[model samples]
Target: MTTDIAVPKSAQSLEPFVAAGVFEPIDIHAAGSLARLITGLEPEIILGAALAMRAVREGHVCVLVDDAYADIDLSDNAKKLPWPTPEKWRSVLTASPAVRVVEPSETVVVAPGEALVPLVFDGVRIYLDRYYDYELKLADFLLDRSGSERINVDESEIEKTLDEIYGKLTGEIDYQREAVRRALTGRLTVIAGGPGTGKTFTINRLLKASRILDGGRPRAIALAAPTGKAAARMTEALSDGEIKATTLHRLLNITPQHPARFNADNPLPFDLVVVDEASMVQLALMTQLFTALSPNASVVLVGDPSQLASVEAGAVLGDIVTATTPDPDSGSVNVALADCTVTLKRNHRFSAESGIAELSQLVDAGETEAVLSCLRAGHDDVVWIDPSNPDDTARVEQETIAAATQVVNAARNGNAEEALEKSIEHNVVCATRYGKFGVHYWTDKIQNELLNTILDCGADRPWYAGRPIMITHNDYLNNLFNGDTGLVVSQSNSAQGLDELKVIFAQDGELRRFNSSQLGEHTTWWASTIHKTQGSEFDRVVVCLPEPPARVLARELLYTGITRARAHVSVVASEAALRMAIETPALRASGLVGHLRQSE
Candidate 1:
């Protein structure tokens, strides 16, 4: 028999427990009707009816209760009550010989003339045997009542499934994966790394992850870098259709020499702000950024302390972390400041064994000398190519033409195969003339000779005219002598769409003559002074250090020029220049002489 039960309005208060699926409502009044219907049956049958009625009420097949109900007094049992007191219900069930008392929530029925128990409840049936006395297996009893089947899977398949599930669960959704999770849960994180460690990569990841977790797209995200150049690079890397990134200066409209204008009244309009290249960020800038943040906004700063420009000043990232100490006067202010610090410690750009990489590590460890030692290892390849003074301009012209002819012959006869194998596809020959005093001139005598040689060798059939011969005077000049051959002189005449071999020539008078105009416009030019060559690198270099300067800066300039060559270098200098390089303290301290000795 089934009874319709009305759920109480108070059931809404039990939503938490109901959602947990641990309990169900029952009508105790209806259970008494089932008890009366089975009154005339055998005691075992009557007990089974009571168990079935309790199961239907509780939404489970097994009912567990205290054993105080075993001695129910049935003095008013003849009355058809809708609910029975424990005293009235227990007396009838315990008197039956077929009913066996077990543990709480357990009952056993014995069949006619058999030691085993046959249990019947509504449409369900259970058989019990007393092999181990009357002890009941709770799990087995639940399984019999639930009547669900089990399936087995292979070990490998199960392991693979678990791995995939874990990967999906732990995978990064957006840049906010860790930071936002921690923030929501109220935790602080620090992200730190050395040069090329993908600090910016982490910042972008955090931004993307946060957007995914927030359900809808974020209204705005702020991107910041310590310097204008770094911010520009990050903007380029992160630029897409939706996301916008800018340098801290541009975002805040602050100039390098001006006081910051950011404040609480005109706060940055973003839910999240990511700062890149944070190592270069000064405390002043950070203060401005913090003040301009929105009330509920989050900020992420990324940088490497070892690469900080102010390393000697001890304006390190660690100092910033330490300064976040709590102050009694400003409680929330200290908490907000502490919440923004995150450190990331992974190096992604260089291999762990690389010299530059090791140098970065040494700098981080505060070992400046070790960093200098790594720098003194010098370029990976340095070759010295020397051509003796073959006379002045007249002889140089002759020898230069001769060298061009030799190069053409080598190319035609496959003698330049080694350079070709090394991916050197073209060669440039630059020729210039020097007059007495300070007059300078360009003589394309060598270029014309090489052009003639290529024609004679049938190299012209493949079109060799587009090859660039970079002649540096003041500006770069470009010309297409034919549809095939192209010439680039100085920067003034440079064209955009072409790759050409660069030839550099330093006229003797030009070297002696210091005109700001003599510097090449388009192509690489031979510089007479070493100072101008600082921070420049070249595949091959020819240095003509004539009259050495008496000043210390001149020797330092010379050191700079010597270090520019990557694969090949030729030094044609007066003996005085060599003496200056050997004697100058700056040169010695730079360790050039020691480097040469080690190479020998």
Candidate 2:
């Protein structure tokens, strides 16, 4: 006779078991034998395991295991078997550290949360604490691997390389020369600076110096960035076909179906790797990149730390820089950090007298009065558009449209081709929200109302000449990635009577046709949110600061948008909105620095 056992197969089925004092979701994979495992275990151990599982799953580095049990129940009829009281659970977790029945190797080690409990199982793989463990492991891995092969190059040698690449150092201190010298001395180097700080110049010199130090034996170098536009920019700066830049995803062989083709077991094949726009890289992604790197390979990270961080769950570059001791009271230098990090301060994009440069500094420092003064000043580099009615969103929209119209008339001069070229040169960045005062509103106003080009196809969202479109997804075959923007050169009806668009992306340099159907799911109008403009720049920038400042109007966002402008910046904002934006700084939660400090 066979006895039928009711197994919980679905999430709903597991719900009843959970309420009845069963394993948490963290152990859901082992749900089949959970009851059998619990049969002989003490009530306190069972309860403690559940709490420990939850904490680890929640990405906590460590938590007191004996803390209050909020989710589980200990009432008289809560379970059929005897359940441990909250006090008893705490007592079990709070006990002195003791060994479990399992061997040290077999035990899945966990910290304070469960105190002495090993939380072990015979065949179960011990899971690392999601982000915290990754952070700790990465920190130790980098420290162990870095400076293992410090290529010693004289200061004069570095100066010679810089002079060859770039004419001469402008400032009293040759920051570019110093950065190259630092890069050669460490396997892991971070080149951090704000906009127009000659980061590209420093990187080129570093590449040249690395070759010199290595006996000019053509070192294998790979350049990568978090996004396609950033990669394209890096490639453009290097102007080397043999050493072309690629997106991190493509470089790692990441696809929709898999995390990566390259990992710890199969590391990337390269002698030196340079990651541009490092600030946009997430911590998890950074960890993956590091894991895939060969032990002795040199790595360089370049970006502006003050720019908007990754949209995901990490402020990686900021965390890494902050981990280093800025000023030691004991006057002892943090050689590990100092040797591996270079902060570039000289601005090459703008002159010392430029208003855009002055405004960025003020915004970065969160100085409301200084920023306001800079914006209000009659400077040729800045065009301030203060709406008459601060409370009226409609008025702000109209005022912005008027400013955009003026820009169009000035740049276009009634030439169709010139209009298309000018549109790409200038970008209208909106505040981080989707409403009447955002990208959608401005895209419609600019495309439909302001510059009404005749539509070639009859569709819901018809394509017209000079319509700016941004790729929202990566298309490896087309060599396009998210944040890549283009203008519609032409449009027509396909054989299937579907609307087709031919877009020419600036990144491509040459005109490569893309069908509208191919872009339907991946394209968005060019009036972008501040986040999308992180790794891009334009000749002119028109920033639409929402009339009633939203919470998302972070100082970094405003500063990033402003800095995107190379020549001019037109701001459409009320005084109140501008002040709020300047005052509010973006805050991201991360613990990489804490881990780094603990390791130190």
Candidate 3:
């Protein structure tokens, strides 16, 4: 007959069995029997049965002897059991650190040279102390394998190569380099220089570096300027077919005729994008480009915020710069390549003595005029150029004609001959105009006359070769002609082109107007607005400062106008105009007199 027994929930009730040597070393078969007995005792006995089964399954112990061998010492009568002593016992517990025994009946079995205790299950294993030796040998083998497989890398050599490559790729680490690097690393880099700070040159270097790093031979890169003229400048720079650069509008496939259909879904094929003359780009247009490009692409935005005069009042680059805050998290991500900014400083085009550039730097630094003036006194040959009369169109026209004649003659006659013999270099001619309130009448007439003169003078000349002449005014259509040394008629007309010399025509307006492709080139003759000429320079300049109502000419504007001429400056204003300049609020505020006094 089969009998069933039950076990209790607590091990306290099993203490008697453990003390009686009935539960100390339980085997698989005995555990099965005990499980049956416990089922009759209580439902919770299932846990105890589970623990016993787990111990057996885990090979923690083995039952070598049964009830038949109760009177015999199991170690000595191990031959009758399935596993014999020593060798059999070692094999059984080889994988485990300890061994245990279980018996249903009260019997104590022992072997010589082994301490077998009854009712104490913890003292069963004698081989537990030897496991550490096996672990140490395994660890030493792993260490040997690791040491043999190690590779020696020359980190210093790698760093040297990187530094050399970077240095060769970029000429120097000036403010412009720092700015571009910062921008490349994902900061909004804003480069503002009056004129000829090598903005385009720096941008080209940046593009080359980015392209080399991109690995893929990208078909096209986004090249944008504020206007068509600026776009042309960028195109001229990339004479090689390797970099396919296009204006933002052309790249975006947008035109005035198709203004209603701006599609952001269709992206142009380009691995990297570079926007030159970025200041002129409207904020809305910028947003459209950002949305159109893939998130993984990289972009180089180059522009002078002060050159945003052509932009609408609300959509100015300065406004955009002011709106953007330096993100702390920028460049932290290892994968992102889209967001970066760079600011270019140091106007290589102008001499350090130029007050306009100096004053702008002061303003950018948030310094007062007095402080700016004090700084200006340390430099020599800094003069103020101002034009009186609101309607100085005639004077500007005369100055343009004279300047054109002088430049042409000077170029033909040689610099030293013109400077020493004719005293002609000193007669610098400039075009001046009224404020923004006045129509750009003088600028228009002067530009037209200049273009006509250049066309007529070289129309029959064999060297003309359709000498490209860039016009400041959009209506003039002078780009239709071709030439080597083209006249960058206006800031907007300035674009990347193969022009040996760039002649800028300036009109009194906002300073931002001059920051474009045309004006950013290495200018031969800077015929530009006094406002635009503030942070700029020229070889020879003729001032046409027109007398305006209510003394509209500021001291800074006058200072900017005069210092643009490097070797010579010709001021064509009445004595009254000069006197008004002495007392202008701009002059008083700048404390020019105090600085001059201090210098004296």
Top-lDDT structure, candidate number: 2
| Rank ordering of all candidates by lDDT, starting from the highest | 2, 3, 1
Model 3: residues with Cα > 4 Å off, grouped in runs: 1-162, 168-198, 214-219, 235-241, 260-262, 324-339, 347-356, 359-382, 386-400, 406-538, 541-600
Stretches of candidate 1 off by over 4 Å are 1-180, 183-190, 239-241, 255-262, 309-318, 322-341, 368-600
Per-residue accuracy of model 2 over 4-111 as CA lDDT, tens digit each? 234344323444446554454454444334434444444445443444444344332222332323223344555444445556644553441321332212212345
**Cα-based lDDT for every prediction:** 0.37, 0.66, 0.39
Model 2: colliding residue pairs: 65-113, 501-516
Q: What is the C-alpha RMSD of each candidate to the true structure, in Å?
A: 37.0, 8.9, 34.2
Candidate 1: global Cα-lDDT?
Answer: 0.37
lDDT tens digits, residues 1-600, model 1?
222333233232223322333233342222234334334434334333344334333222222222312212222431232333444444444553333443332323344696543332111121122211211221122112122212231334333433332333354432223343333222123355554555556555555555544554664777766543344346656633366555566667665466556667988877667776565554345546666765556555565543322211112243334334443453322233344444445556545555544533543454535534554555343222223344544444453345444444443343323212221221211111232111122223444555565534343332232222232221212211110111211122248654333222222111111122433443311122232222223444444443435333233333344444444444444444445543442311011111111211
- The positional error of residue 147 in candidate 3, measured at the CA in angstroms, is 43
**lDDT, candidate 1, residue 34?**
35
- Candidate with top TM-score is 2
lDDT of 3: 0.39
How high is the lDDT of residue 172 in model 2? 76
Q: What is the total number of backbone clashes in candidate 3?
A: 60
